[model samples]
Target: MKAKLTDAFVKNITPPASGRLDIVDETTPGLVLRVMASGVKSWSIRYRPKGRKQLRESYGTYPSTSLSDARARAKALTAAASVGRDLVSEEAAAAAAKAEEEAKAKTIADVVADYIKAHVAKTRKAGVTEKLFANHIVPVLGKKTVGELRRADVVELLDSLKNKGWRTNAQVNRVHAALKACLNWAVEREYLDANPAAVVKKQVTERPRDRVLSDGELKAIWEATDVRTDPSRAFIRLLILTGARRDEIRCMTWSEIDLEKGIWTLPKARNKGHRDHVVPLSNEVKAILEALPRLGECVITTDGKIPYAGQKSLKESLDKAVGASNWEHWTLHDFRRTVTTGMSALGVREEHRERALNHAVGGIGNKVYDRHAYLDEKRAALQAWADRVMLIVDTSGPQNVVAFEAS
Candidate 1:
């Protein structure tokens, strides 16, 4: 069918009962209106570019594509085809280029996810690294692509954290380190040309913590923990008694402990040093462990499935119970330092103190040649420390502090 196409004709056209209808526009050559049996109408232009085969391409749908607009587009396409230009092929190529660009444009979050899967997940630090990205980096700069990330953006993020008091200068430095490490990985993998965080200096100078708990403060914390038999109290008591890292005590499993031998064996995967460490349990630590019910696999768990968490809340409750506003702010790690410092004050050998804390003692020669586990030395140091702690917490207990002689 052929006619001078008009808006009224286009809108009022009825669908054929079978097959389809094509109405050629008399006003424009090669321009067509296709009406299907389903009553849907569309516009297209049929043209041949130079020596190429004839091609028919749909331009738009009606009446959304006005009759005048469709005619103009069809004329333009036809004129281009006569001059040996393939408008359809050009459009296709442009679209392909756009898709390729989009594929190359990976966001920071995308690269972080890849980094975690490729590298971080294989290490024991996976949990902390993943949590850092999720809680801090992703929420702030996840949407920005690698090319879009600027040093100013990173500075803004750190400044925002400091301005809001969300993190201390030391903590800001840690976040910067983790973020820089991740970006450096991206650079290594060619996801980024360079790490944006590389030039960003440490926001604050971080001094090593020298806040060892005093005997009086230790006694107060020990007494404060006496009110409950929950996991938090048990966790704190073990931390004070054994002087182990917080997670070492928190993640302790029944299988790792030998009540008969009085040793807790920490596998390399769980420790910060990535070496198997044997922590000698004092009689005090054993008593605390023995008193707890066998609820689950983890020793310090309310449920057996997972280890106890939320140390910050536990610290707050302990501070409130101790009611010591005059005391300096302290961390759970201070218990470990206090134990070592107390051992020193009591004249315990430095090697024994280091061994009790599972620290590497001496040089590479000692580490490679001295395969000795130093179990006995660690036991003596921890036992003496426990004795001192017991006496401090309870003045009614023995007054003499047991000391470990140097080997």
Candidate 2:
């Protein structure tokens, strides 16, 4: 059937018995309306260039591509066909190129995922790297394609983290390094031309932290711990008493502990040093462990299956208990620092303090040949530190201080 195409005419048209119903517009030659047997309707242009085969190019679906729209598109295709241009093949080629581009494009989040799977997952620092991405990078630049990320975006993220007091300069730098490594990997893999993070300068120069808690602050924190519930108080006190890393305490397991031998043997896989470390359990640490319920695998667990992960809330409660004004910018890791410094002040040996902190002391002799576990020295240092911490918390002065032989 042939007629001037109209909305009413198209709507009234019905599907044929077995094949499609074709309605050609008198206004635009070769412009056709197709109604499928399934009742689907679409507008298309059928054209043959002067020297080429017949071809069809769909304008769009029925109501979406209205009568006017179909006629205008058909007129353009008819004129192009007369000039010897195959519009259908040109559109198809352009579509193929676009699809190829889309297939190859990788977003920042995609690159980050690849970087973690291909590289960070193999390292001992995988957990730290993952936290860096989750807490900092992904929220800002994850959706942007790798090729489109700019140095300004990198700088802005770091600035936001610092300006908002979300993380320290050192922490922001660690995040920056993670981003740089990820972008560099993308470049190496030809996913990106260059690393935008590589050129971005650190917003603040990272000075090594020497922020040890003062005696008064320690006393306040100790007093504060008393107000918190089971696992939190135990967790904070262990960080102070044993001088172990925060994650080590959080992920501490019953299987790693030997109550009979008074040892917490951390496996090589979990330790930052990538070597098995034996932490001597002092009387103070032992008491804390003994008092804890035998929660499935983790010692300091609330659910009995997995370890406690809500440190942010714990810290908030602690700050409230301690009176936030009393302490200045202290973190859980700082408790480890406070313990080490207190040991030094108590006349503990340098080697003994390093060993207690599980630091891999430099030098080939120290790394390769130091088979001495220094169990006795560590035990003594921890005991002294615990005694000092107890005295600070006691607030009763002379009577509460326990005497211990300095290592």
Candidate 3:
């Protein structure tokens, strides 16, 4: 059927009884309105480009696509066909280009996921970095595309952390560092052109933690652990006994220890120094280990599966139990400093103290020449520290104090 296409004619047209009905538009050649038996009305243009066979290209549906707009589109398609343009090929190419652009435009979350898989998973910081992103950064900026990231966004993120008091300004500095490092990696991989977090300075100046636990405070904390269960009890005791890092003791595995040799071997991938550290297990530490059941691979596990992860809540409970105002601001990491400080007070040598903490002593010369693991010196220092701890916690027992050679 041939007729001039109008809004009323298109809307009032009835569907065919059987297959379909085609109404040709007299206003625009090659423009056709197809009314389907299902009552679906759609517009399409039929034209042949040069010597090519006739092609039909559907543009839009009626009601949604106005009659005037359909006529305009059909006219444009016919004119473009006259100029040797392949309308179907051009439309397909345009769609492909759009898809390619979308693929390249990765969100911050997408880039972070890639960064973790391609880069972070190979490093020791993988677990903590993943948590930092998941808990802090991702919730705030994950939806923003990499190209859309601005310095303002980073500043706002840090400011929010500070304003909310969820973390201290000092801790906000760490979040900023992690964010900057991730963005830097993204820039290197061409996922981002620049790091928006680069110019974002620290929220506040962080002073070196000089807070050391006194003898009374340490005793109170030790006694508080008595009320706690296996993992928390043993974990805190080991931190004070060996002065090892929190995670080093938290993620301890049964395979890393040799009870016969009284040594806990930390792999290079785990420690901060990135070197295999041999912590001489004092009698106290060995006793704690022996007391713990062989639940699974992880020595400090509560469930016989993964490591214990309730330190934060445990600390809160401990603070409440200890009930000392002086112990208010102390952290788990402060135990490390207190151990080293107490050793200094006990006349332990500087090198021995550093060695006990697995800190690199002296210059590159010492690192190259002094291949000695200092097992004896570290053992002596740790024993002295452990004995001091025992004396503080249990005044009833006769303390066996080990003598340390002077520096």
Candidate 4:
């Protein structure tokens, strides 16, 4: 009588909107769909919103929905409301709001983002950390919810590396540390249960590297690189003299170096150590710096942009040169090791040498208390080492002067 309440009832109206609509039944009385002026009909359940008199909740459109299903849903809602379960409108809305707030409590990925944002300066300069994650970390676990990750997840990820297990472990350990820092931050903010990475013990594998160039070998590379027409030949000479990391040298611009001050300032953005690093230029370094093209923006680019290919060309040339030297199983990183080794022989202390290379070191002591990096002395020590390397480069005869005691 009052608009026939059965499932077979005919629809008497259309919605004004262009989109389709339908009608559905709910446990409530007199809350039927009054389809609008449009051609489509959407099934809607009439209900009350919090503090509101009445409203229509759109469930779905017709044809796409079935009659029996609509009746079944209405029966459930009517049952819940009958037992004093505030209708789905108010209760579900409240539950959804609570769930959203819980989501903001912080996940591993969120914490990681916070860590990165906090140290934007450091990540910008020493692009190595950013690069490691961009190439490996985010690709592997970027979408993973931090709170949902377990120790097994970390182990399984490393295990999946197959042949690259060691490399994966080293990288995975870093990502693990990154996760730990994020969780600890969450803990400080009263957000996390505990740091998951804290319980995970990573495997240790020692990789011994022996990559110092000999006197004749250094001479061959020097002569060969010097004869090349590319401006990077001079840059390669600078790399040898400075012993700075690849990105440090690669992203350099004319604005950074000051021959008069005997100084080069690496902005906080590109520094690995998250501190503004100062490099003291040596005599050989001076010659190489002077030889670079001062045109456009960057010290290396013709288009005034940093090379998208960081050091691929230099690396290829180095591989070919190493092939000529018949040196096998060595790499460009050995040059960095060579600097540290050479410095130790030349009498640089442990902390100073570590600072020179801008290494982030951890030991039983540093964890005891927070310690700022030894930046000032590190600058001096690096300059002295640069001079020493130049001396070794000039006087390379027979003795392996660039000897380092491995830890």
- Please report the candidate that would top TM-score against the real structure: 3
Give lDDT per model, in order.
0.86, 0.84, 0.88, 0.61
Q: Which ten residues in a row have the lowest lDDT in candidate 1?
A: 398-407
TM-score of 2: 0.69
Tens digit of lDDT per residue, candidate 4, span 17-130? Answer: 554433433343424444445654445555443344554455665546554555565556555555555466676799877765575545545656666667633545335555
Q: Rank the candidates by TM-score, best first.
A: 3, 1, 2, 4
The per-prediction tally of clashing pairs is: 1, 0, 0, 18
Runs in model 3 with CA error above 4 Å?
1-104, 324-328
Candidate 1 ranges with C-alpha deviation above 4 Å: 1-104, 405-407
For candidate 1, give the lDDT of residue 65: 90
Q: What lDDT, from 0 to 1, does candidate 4 have?
A: 0.61
Ranked by TM-score, the better of candidates 2 and 3 is: 3
Task: Supply candidate 2's per-residue lDDT for 228.
Answer: 77
What tens digits encode model 2's per-residue C-alpha lDDT throughout 1-407?
Answer: 88887789898887887788888888789899989998889988889887988888878998887888888888878788999997777888999777556634778888889899999999877877998998789989889887578889999898888887754567778888899998888778767667788988876786777789988888887788877777888998898888898889998999999999999999988888888999999888999999999968989889779878889998888888778765577788888888889988888888888998899788999989979889998888888888888777785656333343454
